[model samples]
Structures are given as C-alpha cells and as structure tokens.
Target: MRPKIENITDLRGEISRLRVQRLEQEVELTKVTARLKARLHFPVLVYTKISDFFIELFGDDPEDLNKKKENKDWVTNILRVGLPLALNRFLFPRSGFLMKSVVAMVSQKAAKNVNKDSITGIIDKVTDWIKSSKEKSRKEPRMADYGIPPDSETY
Candidate 1:
C-alpha cells in the first residue's frame, strides 16, 4: 500500500512558481511589443524616405567613381559629408516630432537630449565646418602631385 499525502503545500508551491514564470514572460512580451511598435512607426518610414531622396538627388553613380583614387567634386562632397550631417540635424530635433516620438517610445533618456535649438545650432556649426574644410582642400596641391590621375580624365 502507498502512503497518501495530507497537505496541499506542494501544489501551492508549484502554482506560485508557475505564476512567477508567467509574469516574467508577460513582461518580456510587453518589451518586445513596444520595440516592434517603435520600429514600424510612421516617422521612421518618413525619415528613411527623406534620406533616400537626398542620396538620389546628390550622389553620382558609384561605378563611375574610382575608390582607389582620391576624387572630389561638389556633388560627391555634398553627398558624402553634407547629406549625413543634414539628416542627423533634421531627425534629432524637437522640430522632428516623429523622430522624437520614436526615440521616446524606445528610450526616455535618449529623447530628453533631443531638442530643436541645440540641433539647429549644431547644424549651423557643421555647415560652417564643411565650408571651411572645402576651402582648405582647394588651397592644397593637386592629386597630380601625389601621382593620382586627374579626376576628369579617369571618368
């Protein structure tokens, strides 16, 4: 004959453990849902579209530009340096409401630092810096001095 159990303690302990596991799973699920929602948000889509537009507008065909040679032109310069700086300025400001919404949804701390005035100031500074850098480069000797073919002849 087998001995019978008297107390319900074992069953109660198992129930509590299962409840804890379920709560953890729910918390994890909520986090994943929030991240997915943020990723699919409309502002992100708009931002991506704007970036694509700028790239298409300013960039040349990659196949035409030889990477081994230091080739610089106004269009290439604008596409490489100006576009990214402009996009960063455009996307992280309080004026960038959609971007702020996405950032806030993802991480509260990051959203705190994203505001309009500061981003505008930074944009101005970067613009000035790019202008100065371009001017400085123009003052330097030609690629012929460094043994690279002139950019025009290559293309």
Candidate 2:
C-alpha cells in the first residue's frame, strides 16, 4: 500500500524509496517463489482443476445424494452433536490428545457435510448394491454349471 502523494518533494522522496523497496521486494519474492516452486513441484497441482475445489467444498452437482434436501430437524441437530463424538470415540479412541483434538476438529467440520438425507442416501445405496449383487448371483450360473453335463468316466 503506497502512501498518498502530497507535495513534489515528498513525491520525489517516495518515488526513490519505492524504487529501492521494489527491487528488494522483487528479489525477495523471486527467492520465495523459487523455494515454493521447488517444494510444490509434484504433478498433483497439474492434475487438479479449479472446479475440483469448488466441487469438493460445495456440491456443484444438482443431483448430489449427500445433500439433495437438507432438513433441519432433530436428526440434523443430533448429527451435528453425535458425528464428532462418534468419530472421536470409535475411530480414534486410542489416539493421543492432540490426535483426538484434530479428529474432533475435522469431524466437527465434516458434520456440516452430513445430514438426514445423506444418511438415507448412503443406506439406500448399500441396500441397492446388496440387492443387485444378490440378483446377479441368482440370475447367472457358473461356467461349469450353466449348460454343461457331468462327466461319467467313473460309471
């Protein structure tokens, strides 16, 4: 942020100061940028698109099952409270204090992503998968049993 210019003398002084400052800042920036570029030279950055962040942070898909319709009921309230507790207790019960704190913090953030609809959607997907698997098994026989007759060499 440059200071407001006033008189000619002040302006000239500011210009000289800024010129010196700019060169120093530019050198510093180049050094910092080089270090940053070296540290972040992984191809992960190249693979990621700007839309990925938007999609992850906020569901860009209209038909997203996780949050098609958010109902702010007792379930939602309970989820907000229970999710962090459950995650901390079940997943990271043996973790240290710092790990538990981090889990608690992460779960607290994640709780906002989940709701009644999301749970229902997960349940529905599981049930649908089970049904499809069962149906698939029932519909098709194995290669040996599909139409092949048994060998009778012993007989």
Q: Give one clash count per candidate, in the order shown.
A: 0, 0
Report the CA-based lDDT of candidate 1 relative to the real structure.
0.63
Q: Lowest-lDDT window of 10 residues in candidate 2? A: 65-74
Q: Report lDDT (CA) for all predictions.
A: 0.63, 0.76
TM-score of each: 0.27, 0.37
- The sequence of per-residue lDDT tens digits that candidate 1 reaches over residues 58-126 is 785556435512444344434444444454567565457676555544443333344455567899999
lDDT of 2 by residue, 1-155 (tens): 77888899999999899899999999999999998888787655754665477567775685563453454556666766887789878988888999977876677666666667888999999999999998887955547655546664455
RMSD of each: 21.6, 23.6
True-vs-predicted CA distance for residue 111, candidate 2, Å: 0.8
